[model samples]
Target: MRLRNATIAAASAVALVLAVPTSANAATGDFLYKVGPGIPAGLADPASGECINLFGATEANPAFAPENFTSSTATVFLDFDCDGDVFYVMNPGKRLGDRLKLRSVVFS
Candidate 1:
């Protein structure tokens, strides 16, 4: 019947509209970087996830402090050219590489 065909066509249109996928903020276990013993690292935006690389860049202008033997403690920084990887300053002069430890990473 004409009415039956029309009803079926309407239902199909509605189903097609509902079937279209929409973007959603979902948690997936697919993308992750395991650093340290058992660490979970991932991006807030999973769609733009990719490999993160860190490169150590020599300081163009290193410390200009005069060389002297004094019993003084100070913090030193190990400069790095972060290609895409995150950096955390857990301690002074700490550089990340194979099996390096990390304290914490905060993203705002």
Candidate 2:
């Protein structure tokens, strides 16, 4: 009877310890961009990076100048200057190699 009661008590303690995190206070942190499956996302794909085409030329067969979209992509931080809208590509794992490519973006 003593051994069985001891085993039950130990199991109960373990369960309570594991459940503490869920009951504790939550934390807030800066957002990090999540890349694609192969490459990091949010980080603009430099293969076609450029100043003028940051938004994209869209039509006119390149518009004023012929540019490539992959040459100037970069990693950017997301911070709100004031009351405005913004978007971030969220990564589940947020691995280094995988966070540089564009993944599913989250918008507010």
Candidate 3:
């Protein structure tokens, strides 16, 4: 009986450990961009492997001049949902010109 109880407790502990979700890794540093003619605004320590829509972004007034300071590569999209054929892949510590407009971004 004692051995059976111990086995069950060990199995339960293992199951619990396996069921716990792990945290996703994030890109370190800021992802800066400008809205219209405004000053640069950014996300600090943004999460990787997720789509991030720029704040206050729209078709007429999209975010532009992206500066990717994060450790991972960033993909900027012309659409809010990170979709469409218009996209730019930016390397870490790199930046784009003001002509490059974007509404969403994803990091790798």
Off by over 4 Å in 2: 22-108
Better of 1 and 3 by TM-score: 3
Top lDDT model: 3
Question: TM-score order of candidates, best first?
Answer: 3, 1, 2
lDDT at 78 for candidate 3?
A: 96
lDDT of 1 at 82: 26
* 1 against 3, candidate with superior lDDT: 3
Candidate 1 lDDT, tens digit per residue, 57-78?
1234222111111122112122
**Quality of model 2 by C-alpha lDDT:** 0.29
Query: lDDT of each prediction vs. the true structure?
Result: 0.32, 0.29, 0.92
- Candidate 3, residues 1-108: lDDT per residue as tens digits? 999999999999999999999865899999999986867789999989999999978888898999999999999999988999999999999988999999999999
Query: What TM-score does structure 3 among the candidates reach?
Result: 0.77
Model 1 C-alpha RMSD vs. true structure (Å) is 16.0
